[model samples]
Target: TFCVLLAYGMLQQITGLRLQDSLGYSSSDAIKGTGALMTSSMALMACVQAIIFKFSVKNPARLLLIGALISVLGFYFLYVGSSFWIYLAGMAILGLGMGLMFPANLALLSLNSKEHNQARIASINNIGKGLGFAIGPLLGATLYQKTTDLPIIFAIGLAIITLILSLISMFPPRIKSVHKI
Candidate 1:
């Protein structure tokens, strides 16, 4: 949740600036373009979420890992992209990655929790997301002030950390079950 929001927050803050500076768009046009990009990303995310739900029943961990890696790839595209179309493509891919991972992670958390505590856990999860959203834009903006690439660099680092954690979760330590007579 944190990583997801962190990436998104940074992207949201930077998109307009990128459009104006890199694409030679007017201020109003840049805002509109950014809005369009964000809307397309959301639409793609919805579609991807539906597809993942239909196809990926077992091995959500693998899906999660794939999603994280895909997000990294998306960020890489954003970093290197010179055209507006490429930026749009990166946003779409990022949306797909977020769609794939968020549901799987939430489902996994739900499956691992007690029924009574489910609401609390969900609330906590949302709180974490909220915190990430609140903090990420500020951090990204501050880093951007220093250098345009810094926000992306920070986002990539966070994505890498998330990927590592997902990998670790995939290979959890085995537990021995005890039999009672």
Candidate 2:
């Protein structure tokens, strides 16, 4: 998971560099600004996730779907964004989705697995992430080389994947309420 996250972070940096180069901006500009945007987005996304968790503790599927939708929109914003502020907003939105996604992914796994098997399930999830990390950079580079719009492509792909996962996560095992409302 760390590798995957690092790859994601690195991909952002690479794409930012590419964008800067293409737009005739200083190469250092994207590198310098990305960290700040990342920090701000991370904070914003954390807040968004907390709100989702507070209200939807038992509905991991719904949370995932909402996060996925927001993420998709964030990606869109990133795709067409022109200014630094626009990029920042788009990044923040993506961060919001990611914040929701991290917890929601865990929730989905937990809801799907029995308590006894949760550890194994989590391991499997981590393995999936490892695979994603291994593949994401190569894929990002390939797509970027082909499209010259790597950021947009990455954003669209993230959105599509989120939507697909959201649909899959919707069918977690139902819990029997201990006490009726």
Candidate 3:
């Protein structure tokens, strides 16, 4: 959750700036572009999540690594792209990635929790999200100052970590092996 949200924050911090500075958009135009990207991506994510929830996918980590991979592609596209359409497409792809991961994280939480403590467990998700979003932009901005690609690179690193974490979560508790006496 933190990894995903942090990636979002890092991308959000730079996309608008890229539109204005790199693509030579006017301030109004940049905002509009950014708004369009954000709204479309969010809508796509919501729709995808809804569909997943409707089907009640049992494997919580199934989409996690895939989503992270897709997100890496999206960020890479943004890194290589220099046009408005390209940027928009990149964001849309990232949105698809977000769609895959959000539900998985929630499902993981629900699967790991008891009915009584579900709300408490859920709060932890919110906390991870808040911290990720909060820190991402600050870290992103500093990295962006060094090089625009830094945030994307950092995001990719986080995605890799998400993959590892998701892999760990996918397994059930290990059983102790008995030795023959």
Candidate 4:
């Protein structure tokens, strides 16, 4: 979570001021409204994930997979957005996907893990997030520099990858036995 946050922070920090200046807008306005919008979506997603977990913690992967696919659609909206309303709408959907994945992934991992190894599992998951933060900016910059169409390329690529992951996640081997303690 922190890594994703950091990655987004870096993106705004690096590009927000410049983009605003280029567009003849105040620098502070560049990223000012995003947090408010994202927070609402995140809060709603947290509630949904909690409710879903109550029913079937063991099947949260299904939720994550679907969420990932939704993320792709959100990205598509963002990539082609040419107006404020469109951009905000895309952001709303993107935030929804993000919100859905976070808790759902954690719940699924917890369900699959042994209680004694919970800490280790969490640590490993966090490590991947850290790596994403550390690397996201460089990758983003490279793509941005490669062509003027960075957002579209990124949205398309993310959509493809998410779709693939969603497909894979849907087909997990069925657990045949339920152990009761």
Candidate 5:
């Protein structure tokens, strides 16, 4: 879970620079554009969160799976897109996924954890988020230096892995019930 968030944080941190370079924007314009992009992403995330909260209280695990899949698509868009609008759209999609996955996963964690360990779990969660914030940019920048799209590839890989793991966790193998005489 934290790994996914970390990858996302890295992508969010560096996407502006990539957009600026790719689009040939002046620094000021790039900053403004990045701001707009981030704001749009965040706004979409908030909306998704609100909608999920209102309507999807019964099935957080399902929501987490959906969010992970959506995030994979979002990363794919970022990897393949060249235009500003396309990138913006990708960011918006990523935001929606983040909104869904973040809260849903947290809720699942809280529900599953023992009461005595709740504080520890919460602490670990915050640490994961902090690490993501710290590491995402550094990792993205290093990968970007190696290849233009490698960071996006890395993010996509992370999202895919996360999605696969979520699927596995959500749908464990079940034993059939036997009828007794």
Candidate 6:
């Protein structure tokens, strides 16, 4: 969750720069491009979340895995994108993947916790998200100053980590078998 949110924050900070610098968007127009990305993000998030709630998906990890897979593709595209339209596509795809993951992530947090510990678990999770959000933009800015590729490449790396973690989360812990005497 932390890493994923961090990548998002980084993208939020860098998207405009990428537009203006790489794709020749005017500063104001670059901001508009960011707005477009956000719009697509919110739109997909709302639609996907609605469906998730409606269906009440039981296997949150499965959803997380699928979302992570999509996210990997999205971030990869963003890294390689040389044109404005491709960047927009990458952002929209990222949004779609996150939209699918968000609800599942929340579900897992609650589902995995006991009623007694739920609040504590949730608070910890939120703290991770908060820290990620707080740091991502700063990191993004720093990386952007160094090189545009650095930000997206870092984000792509984080998204891949998220995918690997999702895979790990998918399986249940195995119970050891005992031999009876």
Top model by lDDT, which number?
Answer: 6
Q: Candidate 4: misplaced stretches above 4 Å?
A: 1-26, 33-58, 174-181
**Better candidate number, 1 or 2, judged by lDDT:** 1
The per-prediction CA RMSD against the true structure, in angstroms, equals: 2.2, 5.7, 2.1, 5.5, 3.0, 1.5
Candidate 2 deviant stretches above 4 angstroms: 1-10, 49-56, 171-181
Q: What TM-score does candidate 1 reach?
A: 0.91
lDDT of 2: 0.69
Model 5 residue 126 lDDT?
A: 91
lDDT, candidate 2, 101-132, per-residue tens: 77878887887789999999999878867776
Order of the predicted models by TM-score, top scorer first: 6, 1, 5, 3, 2, 4
How many clashing pairs in candidate 2? 0
Model 5 segments beyond 4 Å from truth? 172-181
Candidate 4 lDDT, 48-105, residue by residue in tens: 6667656755566777777777667766765675655665676567667766777777
In terms of lDDT, which candidate is stronger, 1 or 4? Answer: 1
Model 3 lowest lDDT segment of ten: 56-65
Error of 3 at 129 (Å): 1.0
Rate residue 110 of model 5 by lDDT: 85
**Candidate 5: clashing residue pairs, number:** 1
| Model 2 worst lDDT run, 10 consecutive residues | 1-10
Q: lDDT per residue, candidate 1, 10-95, as tens digits?
A: 88898888888788899999999899888877888899898877774587778789889988888877888788889888888888
Model 3 clashing-pair count: 0
Instruction: Report, for every candidate in turn, its global Cα lDDT versus the true structure.
Output: 0.84, 0.69, 0.83, 0.61, 0.83, 0.87
Candidate 5: pairs in clash:
10-136
Model number with the top TM-score: 6
